[model samples]
Target: MLIEVEDDFRSSSDKAYEKIFDMILTGQLKPGEKLIRRKLAEKTGVSTIPVMEALLRLEALGIVESIPYRGSRVVPITKEKVRDWYALREAIECQVMRIITRTLTEDEIADLEKLANKLDAMEQAGDTEGEEFWELHFEMHMIMARKTGHQSLIDSLHRINLFRLLQRAQYSATEHKNQIPKDNHHCLIDALRTRDPLIAEEVMREHIYHSDSMI
Candidate 1:
């Protein structure tokens, strides 16, 4: 019975988290918006405890920020933060690309190419909401990062990815910018296929810089 109670709390927390996360991503919760536990609990049909737990989880993801003696709010994407994030992302991704180029098999390269094609179709279909576009974008990079066979590298990239999502959410909340080009992924895949680690690294650097310009 004790274990059952614990499971129930965990379930509620997870549900609250997913609900709140979707709300932020889908633009239901705007940037810099103050989050009230009671209101969120009411919105998610959960208790305040679970709502608080969900806010903590979102804070960990960089999607929400907490201030001492104040409260938690959705993280606002600023130009400074965007620049810092892209720089860190470039450094980590360039190294990951180098490692992937050295170890990626043809099958993996082909898979990435397939992802590029899908992204192209998504773009052409005018995914104005950007949810599908960013999901596929994250998927393609995650596949490349996983190919490195380095757990630490994968973990770092995942953390950075959370910030990327935050950035996208912020963008979606305000202006719709064509920051990431549909062809950029295709370019990176082509660079990997060249079998030159240097070329791949260079392309990855340029790809990340493009994101900086968009910000």
Candidate 2:
């Protein structure tokens, strides 16, 4: 039943959306890079209609902006924007951590550890491109929100995470470096496992804002 639901959400247009989203998050599509519908359609192996649909979706997510004469452009990253995102994340996720500290299951903790391990291995294996890192990083945070048993919080965090991904991509490209913090996920997982809301909240707040100085 769950598998069917997941499959139903993935459609032909979703392929285009995922491809375009990946391109933006992986920095293949630079900030302020112009998005031409025909070129995107060709790149995603989809019709122009679906490509346009995907662009519309991305634009609604605040990842793609439309220009009157220039079509769509990837939103540029800025220190102010990154700070705003971190502030929002801290506001929402700190409360989420409070719930998780009391409610996170042993199974969830084990899964988070595995994710952190995989991320560490990827970094050790010279994952300079950060494609795998980006995916796992998003998954780790989403898992935390999911374990909180709060659907609304999960949805809100998902939107913020998407915006954060764009900012991260642009920051990495502009600085010519990956901004993934070292072992931050491991520290966060450990804090969650402690079953102490204060500890978890502090760790999460620090983890989310760790990049603030760089911005």
Candidate 3:
């Protein structure tokens, strides 16, 4: 009986965490917005315990910060922070490119090419800010990372919640539309096809810096 209750509590906490995480990523919960436990509990339709647990988890991930007496608030997005994330992403993903250059199968390359084409089409349509666009963008990157067969790299990216960082960067840099080339992802795939780690790393660096320049 106790184990079942524990499982129920864990399930509720996971749901609350996912809901709150999505809210943050989708910009429904803006940076610096205070998270009231009672309000979140009511919103998530869960008890305060689960909501609190979710907030604590987010806090650990650097997405939320608790003030001494002010409760918790979403971490504010800033150019400096975004740049830091960009640098971290570049470091991790450049290595991903280097590793996958030697190991990525032809089928994997084709899959990546398909996703790149979709991303290019979305860019041409000027639909970059939509949730669907960002989701696909995240998926594309995750596919590359997964192709490297590096669990640690995958976990690092997930731990940092790179998708949320990308969304926050995009939201903060609304003035920088059309800065990224529509063929950016296609170019990346071409670099990967070269099977030269150095070439792939250089392309990856340029790709990441394009987004970093926006902020």
The TM-scores, one per candidate, come to 0.82, 0.73, 0.85
**Candidate with more favorable, higher TM-score: 2 or 3:** 3
Each candidate: RMSD to true structure?
5.2, 4.6, 5.0
By TM-score rank, best first, the candidates go 3, 1, 2
Alpha-carbon local distance difference test for all models: 0.78, 0.77, 0.80
Tens digits of per-residue lDDT, candidate 1, 53-167, equal 9899789767799988888998887888778777878888998998889788898889889998887666555664546677777778888888888887777777678777766
Q: Which portions of model 2 miss their true places by more than 4 Å? A: 1-12, 42-47, 68-70, 117-129, 173-183
RMSD of 3: 5.0
lDDT of 2: 0.77
Instruction: Report the Cα lDDT for residue 75, model 2.
Output: 81
Runs off by more than 4 Å, candidate 1: 1-9, 120-130, 172-183
lDDT of 3 by residue, 39-59 (tens): 999989999999999999888
**Clash number for model 2?**
0
**Candidate 2 displacement at residue 70 in angstroms:** 5.1
lDDT of 2 at 60: 77
Q: Residue 74, candidate 1: how far off, in angstroms?
A: 0.7
